[model samples]
Target: MCSPFTSLSSPTKAPSLEVVDLWFRYPRSSEWVLRGVSLRLYPGEVALIVGASGSGKTTLLRSITSVGRWIYGGELRGRVLLGGIPLEDLPLDGVRRSIQVVNQNPYTHFIEHLVGRDLLSAAVHLYGKELGRRVFARITTALKLEGLLGRRFFELSGGQLRRVAVAKALLWDPKVLVLDEPLMWLDDEGVADVVEAVRVARSLGKAVLIFEHRFARLLHLADSVYLLRGGILHSVEQDFVKKVQRSLRLSRHPQGGSGGRTTGRPLLLAEDLWFRYDKQGDWILRSLSLEVVEGVATVVYGTNGSGKSTLLKILSGYLKPSRGRLELRSRAVYVPQNVYLFFTEESVAKEFEVACRSRNLGRLCVERGVSYLRALGVDVDLEESPFNLSWGQAVRLAVAVATAASEGPAVLLLDEPFTGLTYLERLQLAESLVKLGNTYVITTSNSENLALVPSARVFKLVEGSLE
Candidate 1:
């Protein structure tokens, strides 16, 4: 069944599978992302496609939907049929009614001030008036979003927004659901929630396809696995899923790093820190105090919007604390959330060299940059614009550039470092981070999901205070 994967010019059976030599390239990109890719989807089947940065998993999903209708440059070479009818000939709206795509960035979907406004309003617009309050409640509860229906949109964090988008998509009940990096910001429990959602859809005989970099929680959930690389599809068995964890690891946790010691002095200290966005509102960080001792990796774990990122920002001097004394043992360098900004330069590699030289640590930071970039697989055209690479490549490059700025054991506050990274890239990065002698304070929802890092100590942000 794995060999000689066939395509369909026309599909008529229950397991309607049809795609003939599909090819596509995004308007923003000059290089081809997908090359003659073909695959079949059976009813009630789940497919998990994994790939490194620039591997083209996302393009496959879009080609099926012809999302490039907004652009007129891409060349379409093949036929895509569902139940034996050509998709290209069908009305675009009719095709869309059968397939739904959840974008990688949900911020594009936010328009209203409150969660109910965004979701419920969408339901009314899509289904036409008279969706009873009871029906909406039932739908929200099915997606585990009942508690969030009334919350303000600005109040909802990244993870919360992701779930809200998911709930809204489920209301459509399309024949196929395409999720792009669905588990990026979810905690272990939240991951479980998404898994259950997929399971429910599968049980209803809907075709479920997921695109993710990390497959630790997703490997077993899929009936078939596929790897997207170099514009090709390699149908793989479950064995391919398990090897991903090790294959991507430059070195696993216990074996990672040169075992540097970082406890001589404090890099940053927070004493009775109180912070809030609004002067009249409750403090996001309530009387929180912490220290980043040298040569250690301190992990901060908390539910959505619990001040993990807030505290990291305050300690890094990105956001000044509202009250209480704060001190930095050394200069701090922060990696911001929108990491793509770092890739604007003409020469990606030269940017690192320039940053290191500007710091004038001159040698230590420079050497770290050389080794770290190699470990993170930053081996593209150094002279090209950084935005030319894929999302995962951009994320890893951001990590390399930010870490190269270190000057004498400074504090590094990483806010969700593994945003779009694949398992191998993440493991290699975890190795590089553990080896850094500087103190690290990372804010994450699922710190253990990586399973490849050795977090020194974990902190919990409960209601606003870090305990």
Candidate 2:
């Protein structure tokens, strides 16, 4: 992806939270994740940091918190200041209360039952009090998570879980909040609520920093934003404009060619599948039946835990339904949640070629832009190590390998394929999918993202049913 990449311009002014001349290396890792990278954040400002997965966005956040211990072993250098004071020199407990972190995946922060425990636990840890419960209820209710007060931690939907996390953060009332890609599993409304919450924090003169890739809804909320390119932060003057441009590019990827798929029998089929995380429990998908024809794009959508990922995994043969008949005539190439790593001496391109040929997809990998690296704004690092590639690059490589190796009208299924890509990278990926035309069934959280695809039949999984 580097060859055709045009250099981006640097911002003229320093950010509010100045990070200067920082160098870090995670223990046991010979390579440096961030080298001589510097960034800044303005006070009472919401800054969006965009970068491919493992590009050091997470590292940058961890370092800011002075929680370098969370990272195996990393050497900290240069100056990190908050309100013009060295962050490292500040007291540990003071730092924790000042710069708060709401990380990815709410499950990571799960603790105790009942939402009232949110502030109670923090207060108890600090001063031992029953008063925190009432305080928690008030704040949680204000955040719109009141309905989930008595609900178990694991019982919340993805968005609800994320809300609980935010409410906890708000209850603690830190001066600065660091939300790392907070929109991971949130729906349209959830995204809006979280944005408003961030704005509220800013209203109180708190600094809010958001790291994310899906800016479809975040274009307006943030006051200032920048792209964290390979740990080098680049400010986006008009994120609002970038968001609009991104939408236009996505609109072109799928429909560039006229709609209409060739008539063909269903290559994969499922009938009346009913299952749940636990038996004797309410089923997530009930009597669900779906079909995918050869050489066409089929997108699946549903609320979080509405069986979208479950159904995709079942279709991929990774999980067998508790009770149902599932069949697939062609080899299925699945892009799972995380890209798989291989212990071998293979370049990205070479590895993709080998994987495709091993699966009899060598032809597809070669014919389409699979093996071909992007130039002039296209990627071309297929010859590099899979472990060395960024999350976005890895996703592309996996998709490329899947397409190349499958036989017949191979069933291609992607579960949240755009998870870590920037809006621009997503456009490029969506365009590549359009190039794969037919033979793909993609599942995504949002429907507007479908606008990027010209004519994908949007089938939804609502309460365990599809149409």
Candidate 3:
């Protein structure tokens, strides 16, 4: 076996985590997802890996952490070393204790319903009661998770959920920290919180490996940067980060061309909206009200845990408001954060077939579905399962499916649809939505998204009401 690419000067000590000639592919798959990929992550340093959608960034991380073969049942070759010891030789629990991973979808790792209970319970079990409490308190404070402890897992905004997941991993005080899209779904403030956490981890001499598209934001702190292309890891300079981000534009259509705002009656109306999980609980939406007219997109912006998702649920008719007067003139389709749950069929073809049949699109449903996906910059095969698509692709697919009918819904509600999309993907999808001429109400934490749909009516959700 040959040594992998090393960008830095000679190391004084052994790497905390090293991948040597790693190759992996899922069972029954002819194509290899990772081809002889190798990299080394040293202690007290941050390594950033950036790649386009479906470029095998997640697969590489899974291989380095041994989740590729151990959990997913894939064919794997080569070695992953943890603390100079072969990863396969170490027990599963030991591997977990030494290296902790926080995935892109933070909700997947959450076991308990309540945030405080989950952290405290795991810490106590792993570090005993006294030490666990002390550690838990420190992590929560560092991540600014004190305000989120009382909330349930489902109640958290996407950014809050990610922070909690990071705290959960930090509670173990692992030697290495792995984050997949750590800055995803975060506003500026949320980004600062995560950056601070990473700074602290590095100061304590921990190895941090980040697999993300937003590497430019963290480039200042990255000791080494790599790009994963064609299933191979190539060393890249820090300036390359800016070049790649600028060159990823995939949009072919103009943006913000929605025939301007319509001067007709509102398609949907809500007044005096009030919502809470239970009567004893605090109100999530306090007498919030909104009016959405046809042919005009509405963008609602808010920080994490500001009740943006809850408001979308209420508007989409998925959650009944505790007390509100809502009137809808047409059908409403809601696409949520976990878009995979929106698909009931086995493959993209099957899912679109069902959608086409419902819309009376006849035998052309499959072909038309594929076209819609392509227009939004998602080009997955019809036979592929929706679950197999990347997070950004899945989100774009969900949006396409939600509006696939011959006559699209009168109102479409999206909850954090642009959470994980690249800059180009966001513009493409936003332009496509405008081209469709369907009324849309989207909730997002990123302010940059507002510029994507300039003609859209913009509002801020704060203090449980639209401001």
Candidate 4:
């Protein structure tokens, strides 16, 4: 195999994938999401694009696939080239066969209920069963997904789903592979697996492009790094990490002293809790006990499939425990992993109004909601649809709404709230959470964010038990 860098000086050599003078804007929006952005990716190399939330990184990725063009209803003026041939000249089937994309959300790529069926469908659709089976076996082994074949797609944990999504894409054996936020929800071990998988793909001579906010973890693996900002792409030296670190360094919030030990009684308590989605299925939680003190944040750290989200749901009264006693002293506001789930209204202001009204907070004051969001480093137009906000913005809005609903000391439950947040945004969120002075039960795979709340009680959830 030849090094991708060696061919860069040759004018006759064409890149595996190239984007030239690209500009795009969604329908009804005057602003262009991508402005005169161009990129080149060579075979046997991995490239990375890093940007803040809503910086058009995802939009650029969507443009490559072109399958969701109609859904976005955007005007695009760009030439996306594959091996020096314009994408417009290629047949749709040919384009699909040559370039494969795994979206930020693994669930978006799932077409079948069972993992085996999903992999088989991708295999059969791309290649005949005989050849597909051979390819599928290789992908499964490479991704370490042997035991997951028999499980249902929905039953798999976040990390498992991400691996399966990548496996499904590999079944097509595309020449170029693009992944959006592949490292978002992964734990340390999961991150290692993904990095190894990327290496394996590069070793196979595939051009790989990864769009991520957490570039530090994947920076070492990237052959070239580009920073996307203000809708423009800027090539940066491989020492991009130092530049990003300096830019994202924020003033540390004053550490509130350790949440003093409980004196009278715990605000929330669970004893010998047991839960499972199915009667005969394996228990997601077993004999797990927890206590949440008033006005103290509790951080639950765990890898995927460790029941962190399940425990939060049970505490929020969204899901009942299969057995054991669970008690809560106050109403808990549950913010799900997908922040969009918390929005029932069309616009951000309307959603806040609904939350205020539902919580019986008297007259609805949208200003309060706006202020809350602004303090959390989310400064978006209130009239904009919540659906249009970026992932980090939506999470901030959701947290604001949850905090607004609490008239007194309350319990706030958040599951993976920092998924798409930038370093500065995470710091802002941590500062806001500290100021709220409420009992927070938050789950995250990010250990760095935990330092933001030094006073918070921390627990590790592993194999249905809290330690």
Predicted model with the maximum TM-score: 4
Candidate 1, residue 336: Cα displacement in angstroms equals 2.2
* Alpha-carbon lDDT, every model: 0.68, 0.68, 0.78, 0.78
- TM-score against truth, every candidate: 0.76, 0.73, 0.71, 0.78
lDDT of 2 by residue, 412-456 (tens): 788777665677777777777766553777777665567665566
Evaluate residue 46 in candidate 1 and report its C-alpha lDDT on the 0 to 100 scale.
85
Error of 3 at 100 (Å): 3.4
Mind giving the per-residue lDDT tens digits that candidate 3 earns over 248-292?
A: 332212255343345766889889999999999999999888888
Q: How do all the candidates rank in terms of TM-score, highest first? A: 4, 1, 2, 3
Model 2 lDDT on a 0 to 1 scale: 0.68
lDDT at position 89, candidate 3 = 88
User: Could you give candidate 4's per-residue lDDT for residues 384-435 as a string of tens digits?
Assistant: 9999988777877887888777776678898988766776677777777776
Show model 3 residue runs off by greater than 4 Å.
1-12, 18-32, 36-38, 66-98, 103-174, 183-192, 214-217, 242-265, 271-282, 316-330, 341-409, 422-424
- Candidate 4 lDDT (Cα, 0 to 1): 0.78
TM-score of 2: 0.73
